[model samples]
Target: MEIIPKLDDRLKDSLYIQLYRYFKHEIEQFTFETGMRLPSIRYLADRLNVSNTTVQMAYQQLLAEGYIESRARSGYFIAELDSDFIESTVTPCTKLSSEDSSEQKEKHILYDFFMSDIDTDHFPLASWRKYANKLLNSEHKDVLKYGEYQGELGLRKALSDYLHRSRGVHCTPEQVVIASGTQSILHILYQLIRWKNKRLAMEDPGYQGVRRSLQGQDIKLVPIPVEKDGLSIREFKKVQADAVYITPSHQYPLGMVMPIAKRIQLLAWANEQESWIIEDDYDGEFRYRGKPIPSLQGIDEHSRVIYIGTFSKSLMPAIRVSYMVLPPALLETYKHLEWGQTASRLHQQTLTLFIENGEWEQHIRKMRTLYKKKQAVLLETIKSVMGEHVHVSGQNAGLHIVLHVKSNCPADTLIACAEKAGIKVYGTSSYLNQNKTSCSLPILLGFGGLSLNDIKQGIKLLHKAWLPYYKSSEQCSVTP
Candidate 1:
């Protein structure tokens, strides 16, 4: 059996990627049917006129990613298609997204609601105007030249002070490196940990974007379940991962805080396993009730934690400014890796002045009040609409709340019906980790950027869409 290879001039992907795709495309098209064996690396290499290394890399990547698993000395064969599990449990999100799907299509539409952001209107635009103008007129003369690899010095220094004081993050300016956002931080993180041959323990029913960012990478992810108290410490220990990515302040989707006990236990587990703890602290800035819980990094006696903080959630998601508060040993190694200024000199300077001039503090205080009011309205709205037909999870804090449906309604069906009715809702399946319950039913609805009126109307629309499946007394009883 021989296969001839052809090259496309327009295929900008790596040669190995092209080879990988060539085989995958054929397999997906069923040109290579079930029980078919894939060509050998050396044979494919000779036919394609590419190096053996390229063919080997392509096959190795596929094997590692579970696209094709190799049997001992039996050569490679098409993986058994677990159609039921694969179709229901896996993401509809392909690396290269399909335009035909409702999610992708709705994203392109004007009223789509996959938005993960806070109200920018609450920002002190006047202060930013002053700083922005100052940068344009004066700061640019010096900063206009190419800047530091981590970020502009002024911004880093300001952020260093702000994070330490405001968020209980433990880091010096030297330990901090600014990047575009969380994904940028994850990329650097992926590079650091990939060489260690360690599995990454990710929070189940967590952030889809983070999951997607690390998908198909060399690192294997052990998706640990998050319980009421926080991540199940027992499950965490079982994973024995190189690093654990957590949103302890308010666990994403669930809104559950990692209690102090669990926090201490998590750090101890990290120490025992010789692993790292990545504290995302994603949306810690705006807690509606109770005293501020200290960051997991602040209490760390051992330097096992890598603290990540972002300005996106508090101010605006477009801020695109996040920093990694590194451990001392890794700090020096990261210093030399800094290349082109990922953060603009002007953008940095403007952010710096905002933090320095007491603008950010005031802005956050106002936003906290505004978002608290919004949260109250959302609770009331959902209660009025869904009533006994639903239960709200993770509502103590954060900009979003997960509303769990109590009826026999499939989460996917509810989402589809909502979309058809011009309402947007994200199902629990979107955030499930491996080993997660496939039957979990919840919709994560964000409220920080929306007004009370919008919340009321949105809930009304959602209730209308939900009425079909949840109409019977068996599904829901009218609240007195």
Candidate 2:
């Protein structure tokens, strides 16, 4: 076979190195199939107008790397490689057909029920922008500089006061550590706790982000089943875990609120075992039925609970601000690490001013009333449209609820069908651990981002999409 190597002189790479790369790229791209003999080094040197020595060096390097084999008198041949491994290493570039591309573009999402969305329309943008500008223009210029390694003291103080009054959490500004997001906070916590214990227990069908963070830290995870009340204390007791991460006020996806009795039991378990509890209050601000449930950290007397709160859901995801209330013991260790600030100082300063001015509280109040009505609209629409084909739960708090479908079809099929109809819904199977127990097909539907009219229309579309699989029955009653 006649072949030539392209070598660039200006690249600073040696001619032999360039030649080696060319051959390797060809082999990887399957231009030179396995067992295909390469051109004789002397002949290739003459063809490319290069010295035979350069070709020999390049061929020797390829041979050493196992990309080529030199047989006695037969010259060089391409080596047989694992096709799957080769494909994985080298991504082939190809263009999609215009028909297929246009089809993808045409799939416009008219309605999206994303699980972690909040009403962007009601965000206090004007007030926030004013405060942010004021902070940026301050004489100190501190907002432009790194505030604190732990976090800006002003933000922590405001958060401490707010959490104490609203969620019943007990903490001072010193105990607070600002983080970029929940995962960042979890990563820090994993670093601190892994020394004490590597086995961490998490709720089955829990938040996947937490699971991923723990797994990324190389910590062993024990899945504890979640019951109607909350985390099954019975199952939790059976395992020996260093710490348990839970969403007590409103369990993720499932929406089961951990009752006072269960919360007390959980604290007792932590106290007896000396195991730590991490309480994530992601959306504790939007309770519709009664007074908000007191935080697990507030009720803990033994200081076993580490409370985490975020403004992402209540305010906006782009804010990228979350805080962790560490126990005194952990705080001491965390201070020693001295991990410099992870969140933006400007955002923290602006948030501090907003919270201190009570503007944050006012915003929460407004969002709560608005979200409560949206939740009611969603539940009412599900009842009127979906009827007895499905059951719903996890309302009364948070921006999303769980819709339990009675059909035998997997959750993904329903989600795909909804997608075809320009509606978006999420499934819970991905959140489940390897040992998930519940057989019910559950999908999460969020109402926070959608208008009341959109919620009704989307539910009607979903009803039409799923009507075929649903068993005929009287309307299923659902309440928030």
Q: Pick the candidate with the highest TM-score.
A: 2
lDDT of each: 0.73, 0.83
Segments in model 2 whose C-alpha atoms lie over 4 Å from true places: 1-106, 195-197, 435-439, 474-480
Query: Alpha carbon lDDT of residue 252, candidate 2?
Result: 88
TM-score of each: 0.74, 0.76
Q: Over the full model, what C-alpha lDDT does candidate 1 score relative to the true structure?
A: 0.73
Q: What is candidate 2's lDDT per residue for 370-454, written digit by digit as tens?
A: 9999999999999998877888888868899999887555676667656655688998888888733232558899999999999
Worst 10 residues of 1 by lDDT: 91-100
Tens-digit lDDT track for model 1 on 1-480?
A: 445445554778888887777665444423354566788888777877888999898888877766677878988887754444343433332223342244434532222334375776667777788888887888348767776787877777887788878778777787888888888888887766543556888788777767777877777778888788678888878766778889999998788888888889888887777778999888888887777888888888888999988888877777788878888867766755654556566677788888888888888888888989988988988887777877787877788887777655466666765664556777677678643333245678888767778778778767654554453465355421
Clashing pairs in 1: none
* lDDT, model 2, position 446: 91
